[model samples]
Target chain A: MALQDKYAELLQTATTLGVGNLASTEQAGVLHVSGTANSTADYDALWALYAKIDPNMASGDLMMNIDIKADAGAQLKVTTDSSNLNIRSTPSTEGEIVGKAAHDEIVTLVEKTDDSWWKIKTADGEEGYAFAQYLSPL
Target chain B: MKLTKLLMVVVVSATMLFVSCKPKDADIKAAVEKALSADPSMSGTTVEVKDGVVTMGGECKDDACKAGCEKIAAGVKGVKSVVNNCTVAPPPPPPPASLSTTIDATKMQQVKDGLKDIAGVTVEFVGDKAVLKGEVTQANRMKIMQMLAAAKVLSDVSGLTDKK
Candidate 1:
Protein backbone atom coordinates (compact mmCIF):
# COMPACT_ATOMS: atom_id res chain seq x y z
CA MET A 1 0.00 0.00 0.00
CA ALA A 2 1.09 3.60 -0.62
CA LEU A 3 2.30 5.70 2.32
CA GLN A 4 -0.68 8.02 2.02
CA ASP A 5 -3.14 5.13 1.96
CA LYS A 6 -1.36 3.45 4.87
CA TYR A 7 -1.53 6.53 7.15
CA ALA A 8 -4.81 7.95 5.95
CA GLU A 9 -6.33 7.76 9.40
CA LEU A 10 -3.49 9.77 10.92
CA LEU A 11 -3.98 12.56 8.41
CA GLN A 12 -7.74 12.47 9.00
CA THR A 13 -7.20 12.83 12.75
CA ALA A 14 -4.96 15.85 12.23
CA THR A 15 -7.68 17.54 10.23
CA THR A 16 -10.24 16.66 12.87
CA LEU A 17 -8.00 18.30 15.50
CA GLY A 18 -8.14 21.55 13.49
CA VAL A 19 -4.41 21.81 13.17
CA GLY A 20 -3.12 24.96 11.48
CA ASN A 21 -0.70 25.37 8.57
CA LEU A 22 -1.18 21.71 7.66
CA ALA A 23 0.92 20.48 4.74
CA SER A 24 1.20 16.86 3.67
CA THR A 25 3.26 15.60 0.76
CA GLU A 26 5.07 12.50 -0.28
CA GLN A 27 8.79 12.75 -0.89
CA ALA A 28 11.16 9.89 -1.57
CA GLY A 29 8.36 7.41 -0.80
CA VAL A 30 7.95 8.95 2.68
CA LEU A 31 4.73 10.66 3.60
CA HIS A 32 5.72 14.02 5.15
CA VAL A 33 3.09 15.25 7.60
CA SER A 34 3.49 18.74 9.06
CA GLY A 35 1.14 20.92 11.08
CA THR A 36 0.87 23.15 14.16
CA ALA A 37 -1.28 21.50 16.81
CA ASN A 38 -3.46 23.93 18.76
CA SER A 39 -2.35 22.38 22.06
CA THR A 40 -0.05 19.73 23.52
CA ALA A 41 -2.97 17.41 24.13
CA ASP A 42 -3.86 17.65 20.46
CA TYR A 43 -0.27 16.89 19.45
CA ASP A 44 -0.09 13.86 21.77
CA ALA A 45 -3.40 12.53 20.43
CA LEU A 46 -1.98 12.55 16.90
CA TRP A 47 1.18 10.69 17.96
CA ALA A 48 -0.93 8.18 19.91
CA LEU A 49 -2.94 7.54 16.77
CA TYR A 50 0.23 7.08 14.76
CA ALA A 51 1.59 4.67 17.37
CA LYS A 52 -1.67 2.74 17.31
CA ILE A 53 -1.44 2.32 13.55
CA ASP A 54 2.23 1.31 13.62
CA PRO A 55 3.20 0.10 17.07
CA ASN A 56 6.93 0.37 16.44
CA MET A 57 6.82 3.40 14.11
CA ALA A 58 9.57 1.54 12.23
CA SER A 59 8.04 1.88 8.79
CA GLY A 60 10.45 4.81 8.04
CA ASP A 61 7.71 5.86 5.63
CA LEU A 62 6.51 8.92 7.52
CA MET A 63 8.04 12.27 8.51
CA MET A 64 6.15 14.31 11.06
CA ASN A 65 6.82 18.03 11.89
CA ILE A 66 3.87 18.58 14.13
CA ASP A 67 4.45 21.20 16.87
CA ILE A 68 2.40 22.21 19.90
CA LYS A 69 1.11 25.74 19.72
CA ALA A 70 2.47 27.75 22.71
CA ASP A 71 -0.29 29.96 23.98
CA ALA A 72 -0.05 29.32 27.68
CA GLY A 73 -2.38 31.74 29.46
CA ALA A 74 -0.84 33.56 32.48
CA GLN A 75 1.83 30.89 32.82
CA LEU A 76 4.65 32.98 31.31
CA LYS A 77 6.24 35.39 33.77
CA VAL A 78 8.13 38.68 33.67
CA THR A 79 11.51 37.99 35.22
CA THR A 80 13.14 41.43 35.28
CA ASP A 81 14.40 42.45 38.74
CA SER A 82 13.03 45.52 40.52
CA SER A 83 12.23 47.54 37.40
CA ASN A 84 8.93 47.12 35.56
CA LEU A 85 9.07 45.94 31.95
CA ASN A 86 7.42 48.27 29.48
CA ILE A 87 4.84 46.63 27.21
CA ARG A 88 5.10 48.63 24.03
CA SER A 89 2.78 48.99 21.07
CA THR A 90 5.40 47.74 18.59
CA PRO A 91 8.09 45.10 18.86
CA SER A 92 10.86 47.61 19.47
CA THR A 93 12.45 49.53 22.34
CA GLU A 94 11.44 52.79 20.60
CA GLY A 95 7.76 51.85 20.52
CA GLU A 96 5.25 53.68 22.74
CA ILE A 97 4.49 52.08 26.10
CA VAL A 98 0.91 50.72 26.16
CA GLY A 99 1.25 49.12 29.58
CA LYS A 100 3.63 48.02 32.32
CA ALA A 101 4.33 44.39 33.36
CA ALA A 102 5.65 44.57 36.92
CA HIS A 103 8.61 42.51 37.99
CA ASP A 104 7.63 38.83 38.42
CA GLU A 105 4.11 39.38 37.10
CA ILE A 106 2.59 36.58 35.08
CA VAL A 107 1.71 37.51 31.50
CA THR A 108 0.22 35.77 28.48
CA LEU A 109 2.50 35.53 25.49
CA VAL A 110 0.86 36.90 22.39
CA GLU A 111 3.89 36.04 20.23
CA LYS A 112 7.64 36.39 20.04
CA THR A 113 8.27 38.81 17.21
CA ASP A 114 12.05 38.40 17.21
CA ASP A 115 15.04 37.70 19.40
CA SER A 116 14.62 40.93 21.34
CA TRP A 117 10.88 41.61 21.57
CA TRP A 118 7.70 39.76 22.49
CA LYS A 119 4.03 40.75 22.39
CA ILE A 120 2.44 40.10 25.75
CA LYS A 121 -0.74 40.72 27.70
CA THR A 122 -1.17 41.24 31.40
CA ALA A 123 -4.04 40.00 33.55
CA ASP A 124 -5.23 43.57 33.98
CA GLY A 125 -6.13 43.68 30.23
CA GLU A 126 -2.87 45.37 29.22
CA GLU A 127 -1.58 44.16 25.83
CA GLY A 128 1.58 45.13 23.91
CA TYR A 129 5.25 44.37 23.22
CA ALA A 130 7.86 43.76 25.92
CA PHE A 131 11.59 43.08 25.74
CA ALA A 132 11.97 39.32 25.27
CA GLN A 133 14.92 39.15 27.68
CA TYR A 134 12.66 40.17 30.58
CA LEU A 135 9.87 37.68 29.83
CA SER A 136 10.47 34.01 30.82
CA PRO A 137 8.34 31.38 29.19
CA LEU A 138 7.17 28.85 31.81
CA MET B 1 50.31 -30.83 45.53
CA LYS B 2 49.22 -30.10 49.10
CA LEU B 3 48.43 -26.43 48.33
CA THR B 4 46.34 -27.47 45.31
CA LYS B 5 44.42 -29.91 47.47
CA LEU B 6 43.69 -27.19 50.05
CA LEU B 7 42.45 -24.78 47.31
CA MET B 8 40.07 -27.43 45.93
CA VAL B 9 38.60 -28.05 49.42
CA VAL B 10 38.08 -24.30 49.98
CA VAL B 11 36.40 -23.84 46.57
CA VAL B 12 34.02 -26.77 47.19
CA SER B 13 33.14 -25.51 50.66
CA ALA B 14 32.32 -21.99 49.32
CA THR B 15 30.08 -23.38 46.61
CA MET B 16 28.21 -25.53 49.12
CA LEU B 17 27.71 -22.62 51.50
CA PHE B 18 26.46 -20.29 48.70
CA VAL B 19 23.98 -22.88 47.43
CA SER B 20 22.69 -23.59 50.91
CA CYS B 21 22.21 -19.90 51.78
CA LYS B 22 20.04 -19.18 48.71
CA PRO B 23 16.40 -20.27 48.74
CA LYS B 24 15.41 -23.01 46.28
CA ASP B 25 14.00 -21.65 42.97
CA ALA B 26 11.03 -24.04 43.19
CA ASP B 27 9.94 -22.69 46.59
CA ILE B 28 10.14 -19.08 45.43
CA LYS B 29 8.29 -19.86 42.22
CA ALA B 30 5.50 -21.63 44.08
CA ALA B 31 5.08 -18.74 46.53
CA VAL B 32 5.01 -16.16 43.71
CA GLU B 33 2.44 -18.19 41.79
CA LYS B 34 0.28 -18.48 44.89
CA ALA B 35 0.34 -14.76 45.51
CA LEU B 36 -0.37 -13.97 41.86
CA SER B 37 -3.30 -16.42 41.81
CA ALA B 38 -4.78 -14.76 44.88
CA ASP B 39 -4.96 -11.38 43.12
CA PRO B 40 -7.73 -11.16 40.51
CA SER B 41 -5.85 -8.66 38.34
CA MET B 42 -2.61 -10.64 38.20
CA SER B 43 -3.95 -14.19 38.26
CA GLY B 44 -3.76 -14.48 34.48
CA THR B 45 -0.12 -13.35 34.24
CA THR B 46 2.65 -15.96 34.04
CA VAL B 47 5.34 -16.00 36.75
CA GLU B 48 8.85 -17.40 36.59
CA VAL B 49 11.54 -17.63 39.27
CA LYS B 50 15.21 -18.30 38.62
CA ASP B 51 17.92 -18.14 41.32
CA GLY B 52 15.72 -15.94 43.52
CA VAL B 53 14.86 -13.49 40.74
CA VAL B 54 11.19 -13.58 39.73
CA THR B 55 10.19 -12.70 36.17
CA MET B 56 6.59 -11.95 35.22
CA GLY B 57 5.55 -11.96 31.61
CA GLY B 58 2.02 -11.55 30.26
CA GLU B 59 -0.63 -9.04 29.27
CA CYS B 60 -1.98 -6.77 32.03
CA LYS B 61 -4.97 -4.45 31.99
CA ASP B 62 -2.97 -1.41 33.12
CA ASP B 63 0.14 -0.21 34.94
CA ALA B 64 -1.48 -0.93 38.30
CA CYS B 65 -2.04 -4.54 37.29
CA LYS B 66 1.55 -4.86 36.13
CA ALA B 67 2.85 -3.32 39.36
CA GLY B 68 0.59 -5.59 41.39
CA CYS B 69 2.23 -8.60 39.77
CA GLU B 70 5.67 -7.25 40.58
CA LYS B 71 4.64 -6.56 44.17
CA ILE B 72 3.30 -10.07 44.56
CA ALA B 73 6.55 -11.54 43.23
CA ALA B 74 8.68 -9.28 45.45
CA GLY B 75 6.73 -10.28 48.60
CA VAL B 76 7.25 -14.00 47.90
CA LYS B 77 9.62 -15.66 50.36
CA GLY B 78 13.19 -16.32 49.13
CA VAL B 79 12.64 -14.13 46.06
CA LYS B 80 15.43 -11.53 45.88
CA SER B 81 13.60 -9.11 43.59
CA VAL B 82 11.22 -8.99 40.65
CA VAL B 83 11.84 -8.18 36.99
CA ASN B 84 8.35 -7.40 35.78
CA ASN B 85 8.34 -7.63 32.00
CA CYS B 86 4.58 -7.76 31.79
CA THR B 87 3.11 -5.84 28.86
CA VAL B 88 0.58 -3.28 30.05
CA ALA B 89 -2.29 -2.71 27.69
CA PRO B 90 -4.28 0.40 28.58
CA PRO B 91 -8.02 -0.05 28.80
CA PRO B 92 -9.86 0.87 25.66
CA PRO B 93 -11.60 4.22 25.91
CA PRO B 94 -15.39 4.28 25.83
CA PRO B 95 -16.82 4.43 22.36
CA PRO B 96 -17.96 7.86 21.22
CA ALA B 97 -21.67 8.20 20.56
CA SER B 98 -22.62 8.42 16.91
CA LEU B 99 -22.68 12.02 15.75
CA SER B 100 -24.16 13.46 12.57
CA THR B 101 -21.76 14.50 9.85
CA THR B 102 -23.72 17.68 9.25
CA ILE B 103 -24.17 20.18 12.09
CA ASP B 104 -27.76 20.44 13.27
CA ALA B 105 -29.19 23.71 11.94
CA THR B 106 -31.27 24.40 15.03
CA LYS B 107 -28.43 23.63 17.37
CA MET B 108 -26.05 25.78 15.36
CA GLN B 109 -28.51 28.64 15.46
CA GLN B 110 -28.90 28.27 19.19
CA VAL B 111 -25.08 28.44 19.63
CA LYS B 112 -24.83 31.46 17.36
CA ASP B 113 -27.63 33.18 19.20
CA GLY B 114 -26.03 32.51 22.54
CA LEU B 115 -22.62 33.94 21.53
CA LYS B 116 -23.46 36.91 19.32
CA ASP B 117 -19.92 38.31 19.46
CA ILE B 118 -18.18 35.19 18.06
CA ALA B 119 -17.57 36.53 14.58
CA GLY B 120 -16.48 34.22 11.76
CA VAL B 121 -16.33 31.20 14.09
CA THR B 122 -17.08 27.86 12.45
CA VAL B 123 -18.52 25.23 14.75
CA GLU B 124 -18.63 21.60 13.63
CA PHE B 125 -19.02 18.24 15.29
CA VAL B 126 -16.07 15.87 14.87
CA GLY B 127 -16.84 12.54 16.53
CA ASP B 128 -18.90 13.97 19.38
CA LYS B 129 -16.38 16.82 20.00
CA ALA B 130 -17.25 20.26 18.78
CA VAL B 131 -14.35 21.92 16.96
CA LEU B 132 -14.46 25.74 17.00
CA LYS B 133 -12.10 27.27 14.45
CA GLY B 134 -11.69 30.94 13.63
CA GLU B 135 -9.88 34.21 14.34
CA VAL B 136 -10.68 35.62 17.77
CA THR B 137 -9.02 37.61 20.54
CA GLN B 138 -8.03 35.93 23.84
CA ALA B 139 -11.10 37.28 25.64
CA ASN B 140 -13.34 36.11 22.85
CA ARG B 141 -11.83 32.64 23.09
CA MET B 142 -12.77 32.36 26.78
CA LYS B 143 -16.31 33.53 26.03
CA ILE B 144 -16.62 31.00 23.25
CA MET B 145 -15.49 28.21 25.54
CA GLN B 146 -18.10 29.21 28.11
CA MET B 147 -20.83 29.31 25.43
CA LEU B 148 -19.83 25.93 24.10
CA ALA B 149 -19.61 24.52 27.62
CA ALA B 150 -23.15 25.70 28.39
CA ALA B 151 -24.37 23.73 25.35
CA LYS B 152 -22.88 20.58 26.98
CA VAL B 153 -20.51 19.85 24.08
CA LEU B 154 -16.84 18.89 24.47
CA SER B 155 -14.82 21.26 22.32
CA ASP B 156 -11.45 21.78 20.62
CA VAL B 157 -10.83 25.50 20.02
CA SER B 158 -8.20 26.26 17.35
CA GLY B 159 -7.34 29.91 17.11
CA LEU B 160 -6.59 31.42 13.72
CA THR B 161 -5.08 34.46 15.40
CA ASP B 162 -1.29 34.60 15.62
CA LYS B 163 -1.28 34.75 19.42
CA LYS B 164 -2.29 31.07 19.80
Candidate 2:
Protein backbone atom coordinates (compact mmCIF):
# COMPACT_ATOMS: atom_id res chain seq x y z
CA MET A 1 0.00 0.00 0.00
CA ALA A 2 2.85 2.40 0.72
CA LEU A 3 4.42 1.72 -2.67
CA GLN A 4 1.01 2.14 -4.23
CA ASP A 5 0.66 5.51 -2.51
CA LYS A 6 4.10 6.54 -3.76
CA TYR A 7 3.26 5.68 -7.36
CA ALA A 8 -0.39 6.74 -7.19
CA GLU A 9 0.15 9.64 -9.55
CA LEU A 10 1.87 7.44 -12.10
CA LEU A 11 -0.97 4.90 -11.93
CA GLN A 12 -3.56 7.64 -12.11
CA THR A 13 -1.88 9.16 -15.14
CA ALA A 14 -1.74 5.78 -16.84
CA THR A 15 -5.46 5.32 -16.33
CA THR A 16 -6.20 8.87 -17.50
CA LEU A 17 -4.20 8.23 -20.66
CA GLY A 18 -6.37 5.16 -21.33
CA VAL A 19 -3.67 2.54 -20.96
CA GLY A 20 -5.13 -0.86 -21.87
CA ASN A 21 -5.13 -3.79 -19.46
CA LEU A 22 -3.61 -1.66 -16.74
CA ALA A 23 -2.70 -3.86 -13.78
CA SER A 24 -0.65 -3.29 -10.65
CA THR A 25 0.25 -5.39 -7.66
CA GLU A 26 2.63 -5.22 -4.74
CA GLN A 27 4.80 -8.23 -4.01
CA ALA A 28 7.78 -8.65 -1.68
CA GLY A 29 8.16 -4.87 -1.27
CA VAL A 30 8.09 -4.15 -5.01
CA LEU A 31 5.21 -2.71 -7.02
CA HIS A 32 4.83 -4.34 -10.42
CA VAL A 33 2.74 -2.37 -12.94
CA SER A 34 2.07 -3.66 -16.44
CA GLY A 35 0.00 -2.29 -19.30
CA THR A 36 0.05 -1.24 -22.96
CA ALA A 37 0.20 2.42 -23.84
CA ASN A 38 -1.81 3.53 -26.84
CA SER A 39 1.23 5.14 -28.46
CA THR A 40 4.95 5.72 -28.01
CA ALA A 41 4.28 9.24 -26.82
CA ASP A 42 2.06 7.92 -24.05
CA TYR A 43 4.67 5.34 -23.17
CA ASP A 44 7.36 8.01 -23.01
CA ALA A 45 5.13 10.25 -20.95
CA LEU A 46 4.56 7.50 -18.40
CA TRP A 47 8.28 6.77 -18.24
CA ALA A 48 9.02 10.47 -17.83
CA LEU A 49 6.55 10.67 -15.00
CA TYR A 50 8.11 7.60 -13.43
CA ALA A 51 11.59 9.10 -13.62
CA LYS A 52 10.34 12.35 -12.19
CA ILE A 53 8.63 10.54 -9.32
CA ASP A 54 11.55 8.25 -8.51
CA PRO A 55 14.50 10.51 -9.46
CA ASN A 56 16.75 8.45 -11.76
CA MET A 57 14.56 5.49 -10.69
CA ALA A 58 17.16 4.52 -8.10
CA SER A 59 14.61 3.21 -5.62
CA GLY A 60 14.00 0.12 -7.76
CA ASP A 61 10.71 -0.21 -5.92
CA LEU A 62 8.64 -0.26 -9.12
CA MET A 63 8.86 -2.44 -12.21
CA MET A 64 6.81 -0.76 -14.96
CA ASN A 65 6.22 -3.37 -17.66
CA ILE A 66 4.43 -1.08 -20.06
CA ASP A 67 4.91 -1.30 -23.82
CA ILE A 68 3.66 0.68 -26.77
CA LYS A 69 0.59 -0.64 -28.61
CA ALA A 70 1.56 -1.86 -32.06
CA ASP A 71 -0.10 -4.55 -34.15
CA ALA A 72 1.02 -6.57 -37.12
CA GLY A 73 1.38 -4.43 -40.25
CA ALA A 74 1.97 -1.32 -38.16
CA GLN A 75 4.86 0.95 -39.12
CA LEU A 76 7.89 1.10 -36.81
CA LYS A 77 10.92 3.36 -36.95
CA VAL A 78 14.48 2.21 -36.31
CA THR A 79 15.77 4.21 -33.33
CA THR A 80 19.43 3.20 -33.24
CA ASP A 81 21.87 6.07 -32.86
CA SER A 82 23.19 6.41 -36.43
CA SER A 83 23.78 2.66 -36.70
CA ASN A 84 21.79 0.08 -38.59
CA LEU A 85 19.42 -2.05 -36.50
CA ASN A 86 20.12 -5.79 -36.78
CA ILE A 87 17.55 -8.22 -38.10
CA ARG A 88 18.21 -11.71 -36.79
CA SER A 89 17.03 -15.15 -37.81
CA THR A 90 15.59 -15.66 -34.33
CA PRO A 91 14.45 -13.41 -31.50
CA SER A 92 17.90 -13.26 -29.91
CA THR A 93 21.42 -12.00 -30.53
CA GLU A 94 22.43 -15.65 -30.73
CA GLY A 95 20.43 -15.76 -33.95
CA GLU A 96 22.39 -15.01 -37.09
CA ILE A 97 22.16 -11.50 -38.47
CA VAL A 98 19.85 -11.97 -41.42
CA GLY A 99 19.53 -8.30 -42.42
CA LYS A 100 19.72 -4.71 -41.23
CA ALA A 101 17.52 -1.63 -41.26
CA ALA A 102 19.32 1.73 -41.30
CA HIS A 103 18.87 4.18 -38.44
CA ASP A 104 15.52 5.98 -38.56
CA GLU A 105 14.24 3.76 -41.36
CA ILE A 106 10.58 2.77 -41.31
CA VAL A 107 9.84 -0.94 -41.14
CA THR A 108 6.66 -3.02 -41.06
CA LEU A 109 5.96 -5.14 -38.01
CA VAL A 110 5.21 -8.79 -38.71
CA GLU A 111 4.69 -9.80 -35.06
CA LYS A 112 5.80 -9.12 -31.53
CA THR A 113 7.89 -12.14 -30.62
CA ASP A 114 8.13 -10.96 -27.03
CA ASP A 115 8.62 -7.89 -24.92
CA SER A 116 12.28 -7.75 -25.90
CA TRP A 117 12.03 -8.74 -29.58
CA TRP A 118 9.77 -8.05 -32.53
CA LYS A 119 9.69 -9.67 -35.95
CA ILE A 120 9.84 -6.85 -38.49
CA LYS A 121 10.19 -6.56 -42.28
CA THR A 122 12.23 -3.88 -43.98
CA ALA A 123 10.81 -1.96 -46.93
CA ASP A 124 12.94 -4.11 -49.21
CA GLY A 125 11.01 -7.21 -48.04
CA GLU A 126 13.73 -8.54 -45.73
CA GLU A 127 12.02 -9.93 -42.60
CA GLY A 128 13.36 -11.17 -39.26
CA TYR A 129 13.39 -10.54 -35.53
CA ALA A 130 14.94 -7.36 -34.08
CA PHE A 131 15.51 -5.92 -30.62
CA ALA A 132 12.28 -4.17 -29.74
CA GLN A 133 14.12 -1.44 -27.81
CA TYR A 134 15.38 0.14 -31.05
CA LEU A 135 12.06 0.15 -32.79
CA SER A 136 9.41 2.82 -32.05
CA PRO A 137 5.92 2.25 -33.39
CA LEU A 138 4.69 4.98 -35.71
CA MET B 1 -84.89 3.95 -1.76
CA LYS B 2 -83.46 6.39 -4.38
CA LEU B 3 -81.40 8.27 -1.73
CA THR B 4 -79.84 5.01 -0.38
CA LYS B 5 -78.89 3.96 -3.93
CA LEU B 6 -77.25 7.42 -4.58
CA LEU B 7 -75.27 7.20 -1.27
CA MET B 8 -73.83 3.72 -2.26
CA VAL B 9 -72.74 5.11 -5.64
CA VAL B 10 -70.97 8.08 -3.95
CA VAL B 11 -69.07 5.72 -1.56
CA VAL B 12 -67.90 3.54 -4.47
CA SER B 13 -66.68 6.61 -6.42
CA ALA B 14 -64.60 7.90 -3.40
CA THR B 15 -62.86 4.52 -3.01
CA MET B 16 -61.96 4.49 -6.71
CA LEU B 17 -60.47 8.03 -6.48
CA PHE B 18 -58.28 7.11 -3.47
CA VAL B 19 -56.91 4.01 -5.20
CA SER B 20 -56.10 6.07 -8.36
CA CYS B 21 -54.20 8.71 -6.30
CA LYS B 22 -51.80 6.09 -4.87
CA PRO B 23 -48.81 5.57 -7.24
CA LYS B 24 -48.86 2.41 -9.43
CA ASP B 25 -46.15 -0.26 -9.07
CA ALA B 26 -44.97 0.40 -12.63
CA ASP B 27 -44.64 4.14 -11.93
CA ILE B 28 -42.62 3.44 -8.77
CA LYS B 29 -40.29 1.16 -10.77
CA ALA B 30 -39.68 3.87 -13.32
CA ALA B 31 -39.01 6.50 -10.68
CA VAL B 32 -36.57 4.20 -8.87
CA GLU B 33 -34.83 3.41 -12.16
CA LYS B 34 -34.51 7.11 -12.91
CA ALA B 35 -33.05 7.78 -9.48
CA LEU B 36 -30.48 4.98 -9.79
CA SER B 37 -29.56 6.11 -13.28
CA ALA B 38 -28.44 9.45 -11.85
CA ASP B 39 -25.32 7.62 -10.68
CA PRO B 40 -23.18 6.17 -13.44
CA SER B 41 -21.82 3.50 -11.12
CA MET B 42 -25.36 2.23 -10.64
CA SER B 43 -25.82 1.59 -14.33
CA GLY B 44 -25.39 -2.14 -13.85
CA THR B 45 -28.30 -2.26 -11.40
CA THR B 46 -31.76 -3.22 -12.55
CA VAL B 47 -34.86 -1.97 -10.72
CA GLU B 48 -38.25 -3.62 -10.19
CA VAL B 49 -41.20 -2.55 -8.06
CA LYS B 50 -44.15 -4.50 -6.63
CA ASP B 51 -46.69 -2.80 -4.39
CA GLY B 52 -44.36 0.23 -4.16
CA VAL B 53 -41.45 -1.90 -2.82
CA VAL B 54 -38.38 -1.70 -5.07
CA THR B 55 -36.20 -4.80 -5.75
CA MET B 56 -32.77 -4.00 -7.13
CA GLY B 57 -30.90 -6.67 -9.09
CA GLY B 58 -27.75 -6.96 -11.21
CA GLU B 59 -24.09 -6.47 -10.27
CA CYS B 60 -22.49 -3.73 -8.25
CA LYS B 61 -18.84 -2.89 -8.39
CA ASP B 62 -18.51 -3.34 -4.63
CA ASP B 63 -20.40 -3.44 -1.34
CA ALA B 64 -20.36 0.32 -1.17
CA CYS B 65 -22.07 0.54 -4.55
CA LYS B 66 -24.61 -2.08 -3.57
CA ALA B 67 -25.48 -0.21 -0.40
CA GLY B 68 -25.54 3.04 -2.34
CA CYS B 69 -28.08 1.67 -4.80
CA GLU B 70 -30.38 0.68 -2.01
CA LYS B 71 -30.12 4.13 -0.44
CA ILE B 72 -30.87 5.84 -3.70
CA ALA B 73 -33.82 3.56 -4.44
CA ALA B 74 -35.23 4.06 -0.96
CA GLY B 75 -35.03 7.84 -1.45
CA VAL B 76 -37.12 7.75 -4.61
CA LYS B 77 -40.71 9.05 -4.43
CA GLY B 78 -43.44 6.40 -3.86
CA VAL B 79 -40.90 3.77 -2.82
CA LYS B 80 -42.19 1.96 0.26
CA SER B 81 -38.95 -0.04 0.81
CA VAL B 82 -35.91 -1.45 -1.06
CA VAL B 83 -34.67 -5.03 -1.46
CA ASN B 84 -31.04 -4.99 -2.56
CA ASN B 85 -30.39 -8.14 -4.62
CA CYS B 86 -27.30 -6.63 -6.21
CA THR B 87 -24.10 -8.69 -5.95
CA VAL B 88 -20.64 -7.16 -5.68
CA ALA B 89 -18.26 -8.11 -8.45
CA PRO B 90 -15.15 -9.95 -7.44
CA PRO B 91 -11.84 -8.11 -7.61
CA PRO B 92 -9.48 -8.98 -10.42
CA PRO B 93 -6.73 -11.45 -9.69
CA PRO B 94 -3.28 -10.04 -8.94
CA PRO B 95 -0.61 -10.28 -11.60
CA PRO B 96 2.01 -13.00 -11.35
CA ALA B 97 5.37 -12.07 -9.84
CA SER B 98 7.46 -10.82 -12.79
CA LEU B 99 10.91 -10.04 -11.40
CA SER B 100 13.14 -13.07 -11.66
CA THR B 101 15.53 -12.74 -8.72
CA THR B 102 17.88 -15.39 -9.99
CA ILE B 103 19.98 -14.78 -13.12
CA ASP B 104 20.21 -17.77 -15.45
CA ALA B 105 22.32 -18.21 -18.61
CA THR B 106 19.57 -17.02 -20.92
CA LYS B 107 18.83 -14.01 -18.72
CA MET B 108 22.50 -13.11 -18.63
CA GLN B 109 22.74 -13.30 -22.40
CA GLN B 110 19.64 -11.15 -22.65
CA VAL B 111 21.25 -8.57 -20.41
CA LYS B 112 24.36 -8.68 -22.58
CA ASP B 113 22.40 -8.40 -25.81
CA GLY B 114 20.44 -5.44 -24.43
CA LEU B 115 23.68 -3.69 -23.53
CA LYS B 116 25.59 -4.57 -26.72
CA ASP B 117 24.48 -1.43 -28.57
CA ILE B 118 25.04 0.86 -25.59
CA ALA B 119 28.72 1.82 -25.54
CA GLY B 120 30.87 2.06 -22.37
CA VAL B 121 28.57 -0.22 -20.34
CA THR B 122 29.82 -3.61 -19.22
CA VAL B 123 27.93 -6.23 -17.21
CA GLU B 124 29.12 -8.77 -14.62
CA PHE B 125 26.95 -11.44 -13.09
CA VAL B 126 27.28 -11.12 -9.31
CA GLY B 127 24.99 -13.70 -7.68
CA ASP B 128 21.43 -12.78 -8.75
CA LYS B 129 22.20 -9.18 -9.71
CA ALA B 130 23.62 -7.84 -12.97
CA VAL B 131 26.28 -5.36 -11.83
CA LEU B 132 26.59 -2.70 -14.55
CA LYS B 133 29.73 -0.53 -14.74
CA GLY B 134 30.22 2.25 -17.29
CA GLU B 135 29.14 5.73 -18.29
CA VAL B 136 25.86 6.42 -20.10
CA THR B 137 23.92 9.51 -21.10
CA GLN B 138 20.57 10.11 -19.37
CA ALA B 139 18.59 8.93 -22.39
CA ASN B 140 20.68 5.80 -22.64
CA ARG B 141 20.37 5.32 -18.93
CA MET B 142 16.56 5.18 -19.27
CA LYS B 143 16.85 2.83 -22.21
CA ILE B 144 19.13 0.56 -20.24
CA MET B 145 16.76 0.46 -17.30
CA GLN B 146 13.77 -0.20 -19.58
CA MET B 147 15.62 -2.98 -21.35
CA LEU B 148 16.65 -4.52 -18.07
CA ALA B 149 13.08 -4.36 -16.80
CA ALA B 150 11.74 -5.93 -19.98
CA ALA B 151 14.21 -8.78 -19.59
CA LYS B 152 13.28 -9.05 -15.88
CA VAL B 153 16.95 -8.82 -14.99
CA LEU B 154 17.72 -7.50 -11.52
CA SER B 155 20.47 -4.86 -11.83
CA ASP B 156 22.95 -2.90 -9.75
CA VAL B 157 23.53 0.20 -11.87
CA SER B 158 25.13 2.07 -8.95
CA GLY B 159 28.55 1.34 -10.50
CA LEU B 160 27.40 3.00 -13.73
CA THR B 161 28.30 6.68 -14.08
CA ASP B 162 26.64 9.50 -15.96
CA LYS B 163 28.44 10.48 -19.17
CA LYS B 164 28.71 14.23 -19.74
Interface RMSD of each candidate, angstroms, one decimal: 17.6, 2.1
**Candidate 2 chain B worst ten-residue window by lDDT:** B93-102
For model 2, what is the C-alpha lDDT against the true structure?
0.87
Instruction: Count backbone clashes in candidate 2.
Output: 0
TM-score of candidate 1 to 2 decimals: 0.31
DockQ of each two-chain model: 0.03, 0.34
Error of 1 at B149 (Å): 11
Q: Give a tens-digit lDDT track for model 1, residues A1-138.
A: 888788899989988898876767775565666666787578657876765786434343555556456664636677664678888898655588899988889899877564346688899999998765455555
Question: lDDT: which candidate is best?
Answer: 2
Candidate whose DockQ is highest: 2
The TM-score obtained by chain A of candidate 2 when compared with the true chain A: 0.97
Candidate 1 chain B has its poorest 10 consecutive residues by lDDT at B93-102
Each prediction's Cα lDDT score? Answer: 0.67, 0.87
